[model samples]
Target: MMCDLETGICGPAGEGNSEMELIDLTAPTKKIDLYYVTDPICSHCWALEPTLRKFLEEYGQYINLHTLMGGLLEKWDGFADVSNGISGPGDVAGHWREVGDHTRMPIDGSFWFEDPVTSSYIPSRVYKVVQQKDASLAPVFLRKAREAVFPFNKNISNDQLLIDIVNSIGLNGEEIVKESHLPAAQESLQEDFIMAGRLGVRGFPTIIFLNEEQKGVKVVGARPYDNYVQALKQILPEENIQPKAINTLQHVLQKEGLLFSREIEELYNLAQQDVAAFVEKELAADSYIVEEVLGEKYIQLNQ
Candidate 1:
């Protein structure tokens, strides 16, 4: 069902135990559609969230984005054999902290220490359930779960936790709980896993693109924004887009997360001092650009 990547480990690209390929080319289109396949419990997937959000904000109009669930670490039985308990929940606490520091993303390591999760499938499947009722709510619920476990240190594997997340997001908690337990929701998740199989997806964070004719290109792992852009370009060469240059720095600062002087210098061909002054003026106007007075004049995207 899976294949081996260049590495010997059974990669999503590899056809190993999975009966399906990780990406399927059945849907044909002239324009490109990107299927972002990931699981909620995947740490790397969490790291990609901000980048993904930005990418969507910038380029979503050029492409159709779809979300899919790929089951990661389903069987806990055989993990102990090779992992020697290293892959278990008990070991994830330190790993999460290390990754949190590495990525500079705020992740509370206390979830693994306080209440470990048994499986990611439960929450992942719940995403499918929510999607059925309201497709827009799927990603919202998924992010809520991530916030609960990673930043808030709550146990998402607990039923009450899921209910609370549903409630926090202004959804009907009782209905979400009821739908999560329903047979249809489970079946939808099963189909998503099956579809992942056919697509040859081997990892947690995968973006598979299909053009109008359904030509496919797959990207794996937590890569930079350019990688995603390149993948889309490969699929949709006709869509030639350039970032618009504006007079005031506010629009650019609002669109992009942080603006380094060097980046602005390159973008608008402004001298470093001019860019610095422009940024400062924006900050003075309270236009969402703030310069922290710590070390460097850090410009933040307040919006």
Candidate 2:
């Protein structure tokens, strides 16, 4: 699904017609770069986490992955759409519930029902601040923010709530807060918007593979793991491609900390019917992981 940064709504990617022309590249580079265009609160983006995690685990050494924020929602005002039957936060909760049911992703819709977020800009800006401080830690912070909203039902728009999430992730909250409001942080966020527009990105969870010559392939919306692999291979045909096999449950848990049956199925290309049973059987006999059914079944490494 595509999320409009200007309207702050989710719809099919490239739903509306675009008048912009594609930019031509000069030459191909020696290395490939993966530009991941996403929004913090985008459900489709959240659903693609497993595939993304697996992609990074396998091809991290060969590719440079850049996470760019797609401004999903600017503000709640001036948004009134009765066509799709989504008018307010309550409607959004229902939509989220449907997404969770379809994707098997754990999403607590109470945040939309109880305390709706006014804007996604706050978290998007905060991400730029964290990226500026330490690029590697930015992904961890983003994961925590997603967990807070999706599973924990926490409103991350609140300044204090955002700070709490930063602190919980072992980052200096005070430093993050101080840097988040700086001119440079705002500029960094603006740059993401400009880059998205330049790339003609109309969706969240969009993956663009660009080689040194600037030749690129754009994959929009959340697709299968093989789709991503194909995109990478298309960009880097000469590179030796070695697909990693999922050997044990511990390996998955060590990489993701938390595991969903759907995630395992997608990562390993397992059949849907066997996924739940396999996860349950593994958790039943294993001492390192614990399974919890909070609306949906989730497994995490036992500490």
Candidate 3:
């Protein structure tokens, strides 16, 4: 996939198609298979986190979500994006800042300049290790890795850093790292790379929604929330497939273990300041854990 500097997608562009038809999901219970193609260090994927989470939260019951690593950066050794004129890690710092501003996702791009990740392959492979062990943990590790790199400037590509992220999620980090070196984990990541190619995916943030018959509608790029919803509707056209809604801020907090101001802003349609006010109220209730980091808030149930 050719990298587009303007979009931060290392792939060809795909328009959201809403074909009219219903195919039975292969899984007996779910309606669609959502294949999420993302990378650990993809700034655009990081920008997409809130929208992706809200989509899953509302429709997760009807969908089986699968995480596929896109291997965004094999190595920065000879990397050069002519369109964006980015030849190395430092070149991406400003672009990340712009993405953060545009998406309302807090991103500290200083890591690109300070603790640059030479390759995203390491974390991507480690993701395969976790996925091989527990499908649930794979996405959890992916989220944590992105949280570490995007806002905290942690080098996700580093060995120790990847292990630490794994450890934070209750895994034996050293064992996981050792397991990652095994043939199976690396092979798993390679399979994803091959699948991405076969699926005509050339970039980060590419999601293909497939019905039971395997007919798919691909939504590419960091699109608005409506685009994704429309794509899902097109695939299933069933009015009953309604999005699940939360009645209150506390309800939402109860659903998600951790909440970013940006995530809550998207989830409940609240302004950033209002998120602050509501979170403040929750904090005063004495049942929430709120941490202020780099001028932002991370809220979760105290338990």
Candidate 4:
């Protein structure tokens, strides 16, 4: 199997396509470097959606982020190899049940019971194709794909579904599909796989933080906001990149749903013990955003 040198992927696995290509190191820019290694089909990736978005929204100014598409199981060809079926929508239904208790994000298990997916490559590759053409809209494409599969319950494996998402997200759907077939798009995805292999990335939503100095740290699996911040701080100790402060929390809450105590602590340097009760009181009064209980405390936005 040939390497898709353009996109930095290793091509299909199990065909002796496993080979690592060293990433060309470059001088760090004003923005901190962050790479989010993920696959479209990864359920954990879906669960990490909210935290990742908040991370981007809050820290986007300080960092330049890129997404690497790690190919999970490509097809339903090997049924036994899969814990769930690519063709059998019901096969994945049970997975939702298992993951729901783990991740607070809502997953309508009926999606697998009713609208199972057959392939994740098309949607995943579409991200590469769009990002290659217009790097700015990469996140938009990624979010649209997630919405299509996990929330809207659309089959991203199909061209029509991809087209619909493209149009819905205000992108040129036809061009995206055309590029999905293009050699350039394929190359980008292949290169992404190669990069993932070299990084020893074994799971979805593997976030790598590379500071301006080229020092790197890795966070595996779906994690909270602090997990990312801790990794980033390891690389850039000077980074005072904290969450929105309590005085400013009201503003941040207008946009984001869930808020963590650590975010406030980091962003505003607020003492967690002091602010905890006030935040809870505000939440009880309906002046804040509230979500499920994690520990003795609930996560709330400063609404």
Q: For this target, which candidate reaches the highest lDDT against the unseen true structure?
A: 3
TM per candidate comes to 0.70, 0.79, 0.84, 0.67
lDDT of each: 0.69, 0.77, 0.81, 0.67
TM-score between model 4 and native: 0.67
Once superposed on the true structure, which residue ranges of model 1 sit more than 4 Å away at CA? Answer: 1-30, 80-85, 243-303
Error of 2 at 179 (Å): 2.9
Please give the range of 10 consecutive residues that has the lowest summed lDDT in model 3.
Answer: 12-21
Q: Which ranking of candidates, highest TM-score first?
A: 3, 2, 1, 4
RMSD of each: 15.9, 15.8, 14.5, 15.1
- Name the best candidate (by TM-score): 3
Query: On residues 1-303, what C-alpha lDDT tens digit does candidate 4 reach at each position?
Result: 555866466666455444554552332234577888987767788777757766665667667777899987576676443434334557676676566446644445566655567667778789888787778677677766764565445677888888877776568998888789778877888999998888779877798888666778988998877888677667767555554323355655544434445444544445757556656544446676444332323354442
lDDT of 3 by residue, 1-303 (tens): 476666565655643222344765542244888889989988899888889878877777778887889987888888888887789989998998888878767788897877898888889889999887777788788888888898877888788988898898889888998888788888889999998898889777899999988888999899989888888888887535777774466776654467788888887788887887767765557888778665778787877
The whole-model C-alpha lDDT of candidate 4 against the native structure comes to 0.67
Tell me which of candidates 3 and 4 scores higher on TM-score.
Answer: 3
Runs of candidate 4 exceeding 4 Å displacement: 1-30, 79-89, 109-115, 242-303
For every model shown, the clashing-pair count is 31, 6, 3, 14
- Pairs clashing within candidate 2: 5-71, 27-213, 28-212, 28-213, 29-212, 29-213
Give residue 166's error in model 1 in angstroms.
0.8
